[model samples]
Target: MRRRPATPLLLSATLVTLAATLALGSTPGAAAPGTQSAGTQSVGAQSSGARLSSTPAGAGTDPDEALAAARTALGLGDGAQSRGPGQPVGEGNEATMALRDLRVALPQLGAEQRREGEALLARPTDGGDDPVGQGYDSRSKKLCSGNVCVHYVTKGADRPDSQKWVRKTLQVMNKVWDFETGTLGYRKPVSDRSLPQGKNGGNGKFDVYLKELSGQRLYGYCAPEYLVKGNKRLANGYCVLDDDFAKAEYGRKPLDTLRVTAAHEFFHAIQFNYDYREDRWLLESTATWVEERFADDVNDNRQYLPVGQVRVPDEPLDIFSTTFGRHYGNWAWWEFLTQKYGGGIVRSVWKQAGQFKGAGRDYSTKALTKVLAAKGGFSRNYARFAAVNNNPAAFYPEGASWPSAARIANLKLSKDATRKSQATTVDHMSAQNVDVTPAAELKDKAWTLRLTLDGPAAATKPMAAVLVQNKKGAWDERLLEFNRKGRARLSVPFSARRVDAVTVSLVNTSTSFDCWEDQAYSCAGIADHDAAPFEVTAKVFKDK
Candidate 1:
């Protein structure tokens, strides 16, 4: 959301992230039984990373955007880098690219922030003699499992309180590897042969570093250690988690907090092996969703729903807010997807967005649309998704614990004549819900609430759904029709004798985009048809 010069890594990043280890191809993530659309065509899914020439040092002026991005990527507390003991920080996985951006711009920053950025981008090394970092030996002790190695300190302020924590962390990561790679069938993380220590944490397994991140308020983070040269830009990656999930900070079982964070952060390490420069929102939402797949009982990701697309329906679904966590909060959308198409849907979307040999390598939503094309179409199903969010408790299997879609207007009627609601606008892939409740006066069976809609041009892709709830609380759902001019009318029973409430859900399903322009919306492009307007009016009368 900050106005800054697009870095070379970012300008072409929306197209091709890192070089591919395998051959290049843009295809859907997983194979399914339906007619798969190619999704939105990427500019160049197989484009070479060699094309990206780093910006000259301080070529541009503003370093704040680059610095904030770097700190978030490193999980160094966006609000404040330092926190009192036990305070919790958020997670971010795009540190490799973010650090690169900041590294190039460090010359422009003030001394304090510049030193912070330098330390973040530096190799994970700490010695008692080292300045500005956890005082530990240069070589962190490690224990390995099937395909991952856990790195930790034996004695230091940053060391885990118990060595048992080290083995437990290893078990947690091994479980993540088994479920993600063995059970769910996602690719494993690439090896960090070029790890600065000359040791790939014992035999090139995915390395996880344990340090006093809890002091800095970080849960965990994954960063690409080395980007291989190829068209897909596949990279070797590493992760760092808090030395301990202190009970005082997270207010939960240390093991429970550890489970979800490991599941969430490890997915980012896997993502780097797929596409190091993939869309930020896709990278985060899917990672957050994977935590549920790996450890459903923890349900820690639920904390983000208040800021998610379902709870904040007026914002575009793919917009990546640097200050806001909507990117991570929208995990529920993928949950909606998995429950609908079965578990393989997320993998299929990732497959479509992959740059691997048989990968679709399409941009984020493009791959999603392609995967959902067979289920009906992205447009239709997405509109239904908006409707589903209208009452997540009714649609999602685990949604009983989740919040419902936000309502823009709450209209109550006792004996209403006619009320024209305010005209509001919604962005693409977002919605607005209006709840009309009977105020216990209109009890006759003849009473009805007549509703009308005036929307933007049909080309803008406006959609509407009506939910009529009876006294028993059962809902009748249907699509409200509209003409080419975006006008429509419908009527539903509103009598207190039989009805409970009527909800009108308005949707904006526009997918038009100007690719590679703004790095805010889906595909890092600008939404071409954003802020489509709609107005609804209601008249309660008797049909005797």
Candidate 2:
């Protein structure tokens, strides 16, 4: 059985939300192009192809244009009706349109749920020609190709900071899109600012329009304070506003929470861009997965496809803090999938969803299960993804090494050791050992044994157990989970009497790791008995 490749251990760097801290001073990070620095601020918040044969002609154009056409053709544009007409403003009309489109795509809602979504669209009222909540510019009409758009009210528009802010935010969005779909295609810029909505509360759905209003809401929620305390309606991203911390200008700082918040919102954008029609679990889990992985991949002071803009880790397990329950669990799931099945599986799943028969919400776990099964049965590959998603911190730890048992220093074995029956056999990625059996017969005495592993330690499951066979043909076995260093030890106290010679054999079991997508097989042993054996010299004590 071939051993799975050791998972790369990288640092965990998460983005944290900084409440109350405003964007007043010229901080290290750039601000939105034209907006004045407020002391603090708030922030917030896809699909599919068809049975190709069932679609009308010219359906295969650029996905972006195809998406726009599909939405418009589906009468989604005409669906933007706000609930109760609570307010009217510069981009309120557009907000209403967005609300309508959301209803069409996300249609299975009770009255209250529908109203909740609708209320978000109506919060921005115009303040005498300039809308207070809508982030739109009345005078100019620009076309941002693939991203969401909103118009700016001149008096309320932060024009100077527009380019700086929009580009930065969009770059983040692109990273998410590429990661999720495994496609690196570019979406057009935000030609119209109205693409995103205002912060009327409820999952940053409203916060998406923060640029329009000069006044920023606390975390941009219509009721940021109330929602912070266990409000299920706003539970997903509400933790950012919990009693834990609150500093208005924090969003503008170089903090992990803030970056994660951005990553969270970018996750939503990716869903919209692709035809991802899933629930909070899939959506949130994917975001958490992407945020940490990207942060690790782009460590500070590294030059790759892009330079700079990388985040650093504050502690060993900071990534775990970004989530609770299944959010972190899902991160592990994704990691396992990516590592074992290859990153391509994730991308295939995302694109495949667009062709799913039902609406996004109807695409449930059962559906995905069937899809995965059809492609290939789920096994250790899925497990690896789960492990990574559940405990992202495990991947990167401070002052840790690629654990290897070969690095151990001593070697000794029982006097009974012989060529046909040795103490142990060693195999690893770095090297293989065979034929290290003792030639001389052992005297009846105790033995202290130590052997060094040749490679890094790996965390795997259903590991093979080492077997020992006595000269008389009786055999005993023990399974093991090697530590960071690939090494294990055992002492035999037979006084070289009961045991004549001990032959070490390796056994394979199709064990599973928490982060593997499917069960994997280990490679066959590379060496016969070259593995170093021990000559026992110490008494074997049952109690430690």
Candidate 3:
């Protein structure tokens, strides 16, 4: 989730009470803008719409006015509220309003205003203004240890307990950062003091804030500001937390929930240090995945597993959306990657993404594709990933051991095939598996199986597959890609000794990746897979 700058405000009486309990010191300075040394290298600027900028430009010179215009343009009322802490942000139609606003405002805006609006559209809203007019406590005390410095406003009656938890969580996060940096081959965080003349600032040790955030449900967020030095923009990272939420969620425990949230959000800081220009899915997915490593007991990331497996199983991993199914569900892809190639492979993918110097957006898929190509091309691995997802536990040892994976039911296959053409529907963002074993007489003899698939004729047609189990129990799979006519065919030849049972599956490919409302499908509706279901026909014949 993205965090906006909190307006300076007075602390509540509870903060004073907590401050007295902890004997806290004076508040630290507000987060400074990022700064880079003259000699430090800078990455190239990415085009708009390609990457999610950490320090997104405000709606306009007057943020309130711009936001009002945006709201009016999108036809949304002002009553919409940001998400609560630990909740999925920007899911469903919430993002549609922002996207549509940008589309409407872009043409009317002047060159400068257009650029500003575009920047705002590129990332999730930073909890607009502080909803609690109390403003953040500028005098919040600072506690520093290891690589982290936590700034917090004293609140509740658990100051000592909260402080201890914060320090421990930061320590855990540091350990994770060190491990990931070593494995991924990325640069470690460093301090810098050179800043541009404008509002942009400097970078230094990681900063954490404990305050009352604007969103009721917003757990916390990492805000990375930009610093310019001779046409180069660098990133400085900081985190904001809802002290109330932390106290409420974890209470007096070792702050388990807070620990998980810190791990997830801190990784976003680490990602900014590498390349904030990377895709949002990659940043969030990897961050979510890291939480499992640091705090496996939390199991918060598992909340999205069903989102990926059931809600949108047919959606391609590379597609982009602000929905929970797209962002959180992305952990599944990383989980599969970790299972297949080890955690280091994920690091390698990030390493490539971090060092990207090419023009335009270097998509996460492209980075992953480059890294995977060394072992095998992305297409081959992707197909394997899709197959493994069906029975995640059966294919991966780690998966088999985890109850989360074991409990998930793989798509079922049809019991028997009919002589005449028969059709079945696979929901959008979903998959269907059908088992097709020939009659006993037909199995031992040489025979041919013909399969036909008909679906929407989009640029990327839906994918179909035929998997056969050989005598040795190894699975042989063939992918089916439809033509412009939304039709695809696959012919499988079976011999008595080598082949046993065959399985047919279909994946719905309809999505909002490149298309918006102008297209026939709405971005939000695509998640439901509301379009026409594809038709599949299968027949078997004795070979000559």
Candidate 4:
């Protein structure tokens, strides 16, 4: 793994000790069972919207070909027979019975859902109204066997696209839910335009509505419009996407992308189902980690493949500019952390999260630091992702693992103990600063520096600090800057000979103190106690 300026043994040691104490309180779980997690809840199960029903257009009600296909995929012998109410047909797993019953009862659907399903299915199937206008619908009910059943109200010629998606969806679920740890998957018919916008076009997205029954909310782009409309009871619900992007990325043809999306969403589902709500970073990071690590794209389950290349650029700011690199970067962070430690550690944190009304302040940042410290040190976490892609030069000061894509490949990984001089004194600051000193000394070779304020004035008229250094004989300021709540000691390339010493100090660029309402201040003196110092022979490495 790449090596950077190590965090001060004192700071790391302090954090580790604190984390160990904190982890003793952590537990594991997801959202509480009944309270719907953020997003829309499925209320249709309470009452059918249209009050509709279904029947065969002419004679045979059975979808012979579709049944044959489902049977083949299920590996049930072709001789599999359709049993009536009390007749036992096949393996008789509660889940299978739930599925079979759902298939048989699909003709009776509520109005609104059935209408929407028909319209969407109509567009893709390219067929005129069912020869004489016969429609399909399913009765929505919780079976005695205890699985949620959803049937697509069928109308017109059964669209091949819709049928194919339905079969694939069931097939995937049959395998995924084989563990049957409480969550169950079954199709429901819907006429809502939003229904089919998920993983398999209209055939799959409606699962979110079903998720509402289980109380899982949605986030991302789909939040504002659908999730938070003022019903505090429904406060946390919204869709991440109207449709699953993986399917779109697969070019619209029915593909196995739905399986991946199922795993992705269900991971969230399981978490929501369990109320595991502590640190959002741990929650999201772990979800992403599991998605990439568990997603399988091949026909045989033996071979494994990541869903796609980590879209490192798309991640939120904290993960990219601060913690990990980008999309793949964050996943890499969690993946590394999990591999080194174990996933059970996350469950421990999740138990703590559920107790929170909401994760307040820099919850993610603090949580991670605490978790790392509790588990001994951040080195284990760092070592996990950096194991293969070690970079040398820019490793120090922490947060080095999360750089731009271009910088990731050329990472330098080397560890040489050479004496070098650098500076950590406050470079430039005016007298208007508060109680602290204008300058400070930072001796630790650590890269990311964090500072916490003490006084009320410190909190009000906050100060800002920047880490500047000389690179290749010339002075260059990096974009990594911090305010009162936090400070970062950066480790970029430095030159000892060209420059005498680098400085760590406060800079007051803002003149306005009028915004001091939250005990806010724009300028203050820095004590300089923990300001990181410049060094000559620091060790660096690039393992990638």
Residues 87-175 of candidate 3: C-alpha lDDT, one tens digit per residue: 44322133222333343334456655554444443222122232322234233456666556665545533132466656665675566
Expressed as tens digits, the lDDT of each residue in 169-216 for candidate 2 is 434434543553344221211111111122212112212333322122
Model 1, runs deviating above 4 Å: 1-64, 72-79, 85-119, 126-138, 193-199, 414-416
Q: What TM-score, computed on C-alpha atoms, does each candidate reach?
A: 0.82, 0.36, 0.62, 0.36
TM-score between candidate 3 and the true structure: 0.62
> Model 2: runs farther than 4 Å from truth?
1-116, 121-163, 170-208, 212-248, 251-266, 272-277, 292-325, 351-544
What is the model-wide C-alpha lDDT for candidate 3?
Answer: 0.49
TM-score of 1: 0.82
How accurate locally is residue 255 in candidate 2, as Cα lDDT from 0 to 100? 35
- Tell me the deviation in Å of residue 266 in model 4: 2.3
- Clash count, one per candidate: 19, 126, 15, 98
The root-mean-square deviation over C-alpha atoms between each candidate and the true structure, in angstroms, is 8.4, 20.3, 10.7, 21.7
For candidate 4, give the lDDT of residue 516: 12
Error of 1 at 324 (Å): 2.6
Please, what is the whole-model Cα lDDT of each candidate in the order they appear?
0.69, 0.28, 0.49, 0.27
Superposed model 3: Cα runs more than 4 Å off: 1-134, 155-161, 189-203, 212-215, 228-233, 244-254, 309-311, 355-361, 398-417, 420-464, 468-502, 507-535, 540-544
Q: Candidate 1: worst 10 consecutive residues by lDDT?
A: 35-44
Local accuracy of candidate 1 as per-residue lDDT tens digits, 1-544: 1111122221121122232432333322221121111111121122244432111112322478878877665545554455555445444244444654464455567766765655554445434443444335545678887778888877766689898999999999999888987799887776543222232443446778887766555677676543444443465567778888887766679999999988988888777656666777888899989988988988888888888877887877887775678977899888888887877999888878776668886778888888988998776777777787877888887777888888888788766434547578888888888988877878888888888998988877788988898878687888865689999899888888898888888888888877766357765577887878888887788887
